[model samples]
Target: MKRLLILAALLPFTALAAPLNVDNNPNQPGYEIPSQQRMQSRMLNQQQQNKGMLNQQLKVQTQQQQQHLQNQMNNNQQRIQQTQPGMLNTPSTKPVAPRNGDMLKQY
Candidate 1:
């Protein structure tokens, strides 16, 4: 019983005397030593900034692609409109002349 009491007192003293080494060197690469809350906040900020830039780039690229496709479609439509009359107005009822007498006989 006495040894148990002594050990219990020593245990509390050991707990109180424990050292807390919490210093982190900022100059070290890939050394993540921040508190949980600070680390989360920093990660969220970085993610937001990256997402913002990515969204901006995606928007610009989408707009450029849409404009390019629209221009191509307009050009194709204009060309089709310009060529439609020529195709539709050509005479299609004429019989083709045979190149040889044998072909004419077969027809």
Candidate 2:
């Protein structure tokens, strides 16, 4: 009867010990499962970094295009002013004289 009692007490311990051995097997080859929340957070961080870089590139491109257009507009305005300075300042109302001696009278 004493042996039976001792065996009964040790049976529960053996059952618990078996699971511990299986849990602690470091050399067992298997897929490492990352927790779902950790994977989601990592993916979100990567996406945000990509978006930030893209936004910075776009901003720089837009600034460069605007500067180019402004320079072109300034150069065109300068050329126009040099070509016709009086045209911009005064409106002429005189009728131009004909080169030939024939005059057409407008009554």
Candidate 3:
């Protein structure tokens, strides 16, 4: 049990000490650091491309929503015009002036 505990403690250190290979090309040396750098750069470019596509989609959706709102506003304006074309020339809310003096006059 003591040996097992010691092996477990040393296992992570052994893994860290081992060389990791990032190169997919079998013709090149496994220790070539440039391949890892290239891989990282490729990943970054893919992320940038994804972001660009998302931005384009967002722009298209925003434009579509804006056009829909504009159409609704135009329809509402047309309805108002058709329903009451002379709304601007509306008469006062007061009743017509009483004719022939007030009926309440004791005359």
Candidate 4:
């Protein structure tokens, strides 16, 4: 029949006019707004900058500790040289004077 053919042609268009289900779709929200993407990118950049600063500070602290240890070693070496320069094995610097007990013994 002619009426049945016309009705069938108009039937497919009705489905296209229906409202889309926005809640069930995943790709709809991100494409609609760009501010959320920008915020996430800024947070990632800030974390990387903080990590770089921490590494630089750690290197400076290590250098300072090494320099302090070297200075201490040099100071200790200088002290040892000043305290005992020549007499390492001798116990005391006592005098040897001739007495009556030494005169009876043969030289």
Candidate 5:
């Protein structure tokens, strides 16, 4: 029948016109969803910014550590040199005096 044909034709469009579901979650209030492109761009930008900040921090920390290590090494060298440079390196320093116990002849 022509009426049946018309009803069938309109049914598909009726389903399309139905309201979209929202606020399905009960625990939380409604939340906004940004467009896919905008969210992706924001995520990428934040990631890069965080990575850059971390990289700078790491670079500064590493440089400070390297300088600290270099200073420590320089201090150690200075201490070594100050303590006994000629005795260890140059032969001109007098030999260490023999201990009295070692002078006794072994049986």
Candidate 6:
């Protein structure tokens, strides 16, 4: 029982002492670091490309929105012009004179 316990304790240390192969030996079942690195780089590159495409799409959408707003403003201005063709004339400020004031002369 003591030997079994000692073996179990040394087993973890023995596994740590063994060096994993840098060479992707097909016989060994460990992961290949170089392949993983290449895949990560490819993923990063694809992400950058996707971001660029999104930026382009956003710019196009913004331009379309601005154009739509500008068109609406132009239509509103045209409607206002159609409603009022000319400047409004001002009212006359001159006072009217009273007609036939013979009562005042008699008084």
Return the top candidate by lDDT.
Answer: 2
Per-candidate TM-score against the hidden true structure: 0.52, 0.48, 0.49, 0.50, 0.48, 0.51
For model 3, how does the per-residue alpha-carbon lDDT over 1-107 read when each residue is reduced to its tens digit?
99999999999988976555325455676545677889999999999999999999999999999999999999999888876867655665877788886657775
Error of 2 at 96 (Å): 18
Candidate 3, poorest ten consecutive residues by summed lDDT: 17-26
Comparing 3 and 6 on lDDT, the stronger one: 3
- Candidate 2 accuracy as TM-score: 0.48
The TM-score that candidate 1 achieves is 0.52
Q: Cα RMSD to native, each candidate?
A: 11.0, 8.6, 13.9, 10.2, 10.1, 12.5
The global C-alpha lDDT for each of the candidates, from Candidate 1 onward, is 0.81, 0.85, 0.83, 0.81, 0.81, 0.82
lDDT of 5 by residue, 21-84 (tens): 3443334465544576589899999999999999999999999999999999999999898768
Better of 3 and 5 by lDDT: 3
Ranking by TM-score: 1, 6, 4, 3, 5, 2
Question: Model 3 Cα displacement at 87 (Å)?
Answer: 6.4
lDDT of 4 at 3: 98
Q: Which residue runs does candidate 5 get wrong by more than 4 Å?
A: 1-34, 85-107
C-alpha positional error of residue 102 in candidate 4 after TM-score superposition, expressed in Å: 29
Clashing pairs in 4: none
Writing each residue's lDDT as its tens digit, candidate 1 over 20-39 gives: 32235556575575687698
lDDT by residue for model 2 (69-107), tens: 999999999989876857665576899777665876679
Model 3, runs deviating above 4 Å: 1-32, 86-107
- lDDT for model 5, please: 0.81
TM-score of 4: 0.50
| Clash pairs detected, candidate 5 | none
Q: Which pairs of residues collide in candidate 1? A: none
lDDT of each residue in 1-107, candidate 6, tens digit only:
99999999999987865655435565667655777889999999999999999999999999999999999999999877776755424454687777887347754
**Number of clashes recorded per candidate:** 0, 0, 0, 0, 0, 0
Residue 84, model 2, lDDT:
88
